[model samples]
Target: MYAELFRLDGRVALVTGGSRGIGLACAEALGEAGARIAISARSRDEGEKAVRHLAGKGIEALYLPADISSESAAQAVVKQAAAELGGLDILVNNAGIARHGDSLDVKPETWDEVINTNLTGLFWCCRAAIETMVAAGRGSIVNIGSISGYISNLPQNQVAYNASKAGVHMLTKSLAGEFAKNNIRINAVAPGYIETAMTQGGLDDPEWSKIWLGMTPLGRTGKPSEVAAAVLYLASDAASYVTGSVLTIDGGYTIH
Candidate 1:
């Protein structure tokens, strides 16, 4: 009976940016736990492939297309997921973009793009999902954040990304406080130097990798599945009492 608390059978989940990297990994993990999945991405082909992969694992998954940078598009995604998947019990805000520029040279347009996609888009999805979830009286939200929110990466400056992620941390807390009465929980997962396509450049540089490993107590970069595990834990009833929390899956990179 206790084991059932961790089971996600019959739960419906919507994961933004679910075509690849951390989002796809979370989708896979949740699917394995028996949750029906709606994998949303801007790339139709990738979204279809992700859904197929999940389906192959015996999980009911659907491909929903949305570019979360557009507020209207983000809202539409939640509506479609709710309509098609029956209702959403989980929402993972994993859609984000990272653009690097000198802090002083970063243009307003780029800053706006990063903020719109990473922070504002997350709000739009949460707002839409909450409409149905509030009526349902139960839901779980996991916002994918990054260690860069707390500490900036050297060499490349991404002030917009850092600010957006910091906002995400507070956003999760604020939403959790407001929605706890509705039986809805909101939490965030901050990942450190994960080995994803976005970070391949850093890993390819032996000197950079050495510096990264030196900073990371684990002496290695993290994998997407590791971040997915953190998400799965927060999504499941195993974290029923957890809300307004930031679970860091950084492999000790933030300790120093």
Candidate 2:
């Protein structure tokens, strides 16, 4: 039953930044696969809205609200998910912020906020989830990185975002080695120019859109569901032997 490998009947997954965009898609995918889902993010309104949407599809979902930029807040959401969901078997770190500017013109606060949310905060959530997973003797973690981590994007100067996502890729490898003994797996997905709210602005801009689509071999953007499918595969037993790897979904943008 190869398909059974992707089933998560008794698993509990905690998805950060699960209110919208790729995060929500990941939550829906995991939930549809039979995993009980708990999603956390800064916006309570959006969180509740996401939960309702999941419910409409007969998916059991909980929205745990928190601003993940703070270590305490990030850790609290992880712990809360474990307590509420009975145990945490999977963790998806999708909460990240992007601040695009020239390195010299970037505000100190802007850089701090992006790094705090995208890297440091993701690590905080992972650390807490690992603690519980270690006790449970098994777990999985899937991080949402970006193709920008591998190559700089054209027409946008997002130094902070690029650095943070690059760190995420390395961190995934580092932790994968550190925790393999505990039977915990860690991996990342590096997406390029997906059609999410976070990236829609670029797609809407004629200049940005032309360069973006032109550079991609596929000649178009990606859907959130495409990213979600990858996340679901990594989070399930389907990727049991996969760890410390970055799966790139870039529509051939990085091939060159």
TM-score (all chains, Cα) for each model: 0.97, 0.99
Winner by lDDT: 2
Supply every candidate's count of residue pairs whose N, Cα or C atoms clash at under 3 angstroms. Answer: 0, 0
Clashing pairs in 2: none
TM-score of 2: 0.99
Candidate 2 C-alpha lDDT tens digits along 28-140: 99999999999998888999999999999999899999999999999999999999989999999999888777989998899999999999999999999999999999999
lDDT of each: 0.92, 0.95
lDDT of 1: 0.92
Query: Candidate 1, which segments miss by more than 4 Å at Cα?
Result: none
Q: Best by TM-score, which number? A: 2
Q: Give the TM-score of candidate 1.
A: 0.97
Residues 1-256, candidate 1: write the lDDT tens digits: 6778778998999999999999999999899888989989999999998888877877778889999999899999999999998999999999999988788998889999999999999999999999989999999999999998789876567899999999999999999999999999999999998989878887898887878778899988999999999899999999999999999998898888
